[model samples]
Target: MIIDTKKLQKEVLENKKNHGFNTTDIEFELLRLYGETNELFEAWRKQDKENIDEELADVGIFLLGISEMLGSGLGEDITNKMKVNRKRIYKNRDK
Candidate 1:
């Protein structure tokens, strides 16, 4: 199935608002994302490739929620920046 990431992100934020997740809950989500990423890294280290993809997807979901809360389109912004940086940044760093 196709996913509309923007819509999904919006829904996440709306749900959080509706459920009244306070500042501490938001902070908890951020910490959860960090822990998920750590789990992904640990799975990678163990060469357990299967679970890593799911864990990383979990991280992406939380990150999208946080970014939406912050009024940011992180995926779009990052992709756009990478396009600009691909040539200049890599070339300069290689020098």
Candidate 2:
């Protein structure tokens, strides 16, 4: 099944608006994203599949929020950036 990321992003925006959240600080969003990433990592370390899934969702939520806050099309940006990443050859990624 294909997930409609654009639709998901729109839904996130709507949800935020419903909750009376106004996008004010990009720095706060960045910090939230960082915290969510660490939560994902912690879930992985604990081998908690359920928590991992939830953390993954949180990561996506923050990412989409950040994109919307920055007034960029999240879906388009992801597609374009991934295209470039897919073509790039990388070595020593772990180094």
In model 2, the runs with Cα more than 4 Å from the true position are: none
Name the top lDDT candidate.
Answer: 2
TM-score of 1: 0.69
- Candidate 1 — which residues are off by over 4 angstroms? 1-3, 14-27, 91-95
Q: Which lDDT tens digits does candidate 1 get at residues 10-64?
A: 8877776798864236678888889999999998998888898888887887888
* Local distance difference test, each candidate: 0.79, 0.87
Q: Per-residue alpha-carbon lDDT of model 2 for 14-90, expressed as tens digits?
A: 88889987666889879988999999999999999999999999999988887877778888997899999999999
RMSD of each: 3.6, 1.9
lDDT of 2 at 35: 97
lDDT of 1: 0.79
**What does the lDDT read for residue 33 in candidate 1?**
84
TM per prediction: 0.69, 0.83
For residue 11, what is the lDDT in candidate 2?
A: 80
